[model samples]
Target: MTTSSTQQQTSDAFGYKWARRDSYESPAVRDASRAWLLSRYCGGDAAVLDAWLAGGPKTILDAGCGAGFSALLLFGERLRDHDYVGVDISSAVEVAAQRFAEAEIPARFMRADIATVDLPPASVDLLFSEGVLHHTDNPATTLRHLAGLLRDGGRALFYVYAKKSVVREFTDDHIRQQLMPLSDAEAWAALEPLTKLGIALGALEGTIDVPEDIPLLGIPKGSYPLQRFFYWHVCKAFYRADFSVDEMNHINFDWFRPANCHRQTPEEVRAWCTAAGLEVETLRVEEAGMTVVARRVSAGATYV
Candidate 1:
């Protein structure tokens, strides 16, 4: 896996942002709560959850293990005796080490790019990556490399941003370009209006009835509960009663800071899996993106 100068720069930027993460554990969150959140993070895809709960994996790779939250939830206080490896291309690996150590989950954290990260081929049983690949310079290439790490029967779950309307595509790129050049502080300042827009929309209670799509705004025609719609459409960084202000800010920062963010269509993702010799097991597409659970297949098995 070769890294380009551009990819290195983007990795460096993410490293800085995640290094100063607000809180490793949310307020009053326990082992159970963390697990619950992880489940929700998977978009409540039952097949994926069921496979995870079946619990036969001996080695797990948290590929983009941001701050080790997913690793902690997966192995710390529940699954035991598994070799859990968390790798990231940032100082967030240090934060993950601290958090996992506190949780008594014996795990390894490495500051390495997922595309180039080293582990024996076909040595992993489960690979869990969420919200990571799309941030890379070439998501298809990265996904293929990661897939090679899994054993023939091994499985991986990937969460990637989905392609939205043309209007949304232009707006997102425009905002990111403006913010990418600014310092972290300055970028956060620039995102204040967008953040507030999200909050203001989230504050509206009750459901909205829509009869047709608003193409110009990239809003689809649907009956959206006010809060849910605000979250999915207006902005994803809205303040929540369950999250800290810093957490909200982190979400906003995550969106605008990254220099390489590529949204993919389902057809493209399917093509990737097929080329990588993977068979899709579970797939759930939400407003933000799609959550896919695929297993490596080397034989005559079909992939869809």
Candidate 2:
């Protein structure tokens, strides 16, 4: 949608900016939150992370790390040897650092815009980014920079929003355009209609079944993750959608984000990878987004 603000900051798809907020995250919200945390380095998609992490003994850079969720999940209890550096433009950097301290993990966080974050060339073994690049000033340029940070034979795991889901599309558009820019109080007021609708629809109790007509692409069937999906759309999308200390501060930062890119097609991503000189290893579609693992190699270079 069209946003009119003195300053527009980069935002995740649908402007669902992730940060610390006091609003107690609902159960479904918490599950979604945990899922996102699990999606960082080894992300929720283990296949992509595992493949990229094949040949190891290297450190990882959690590019666009929002809350250190992914970093902790990836190198948490099982694999704690690999060092991790988490970076985000938001002040969550401090929160993330604290989380690492509590977890006793060799992790650190910095508040730096990934696009302009000046990292040494070819210094990292793996670059893990999820739902971050698209929200940057220039997504393609961001990807190029992230790729540059990878050492030779190093792999990158990226999870970008894919333009294949209808429900998700509706949810984001409704929030960004019809009801964004409202103060949390005002936004919460505006959300009454949605919450009511969800309750009514859910109250249907399978009375009026949704006809098997237009397929809701990407979104799985059978009440799969329905509670979380509803909360995200009805409440979280409108109010502060995070659960952490000093949340309003984080919410305000998210409110000012300008650049908000979104889902792309496989053809689009594949073309970009080829043009960037990265070899695509795996490409898959998920309910909410897509996963791509590509390796940046020199001309005439190959890998096993």
Which prediction has the highest TM-score against the true structure?
Answer: 1
Candidate 2 ranges beyond 4 A from true positions: 1-56, 164-171, 184-196, 199-204, 207-259
Residue 172 of model 2 has an lDDT of 58
Candidate 2 lDDT over 1-304, as tens digits, reads 2322311434231223344323323454556555664554334665655555556556788888776665565545533666677888765666667767777777756677777677798898878886676676667777887788888777777878666456655655556555446653455455555544544444343322223444545433434233444533233332332333233323323322233656678788887677666788777766446677778788887787
Quote each prediction's TM-score: 0.84, 0.69
- The pairs that clash in candidate 1 are none
lDDT for model 2 comes to 0.59
Best by lDDT: 1
Worst 10 residues of 2 by lDDT: 6-15
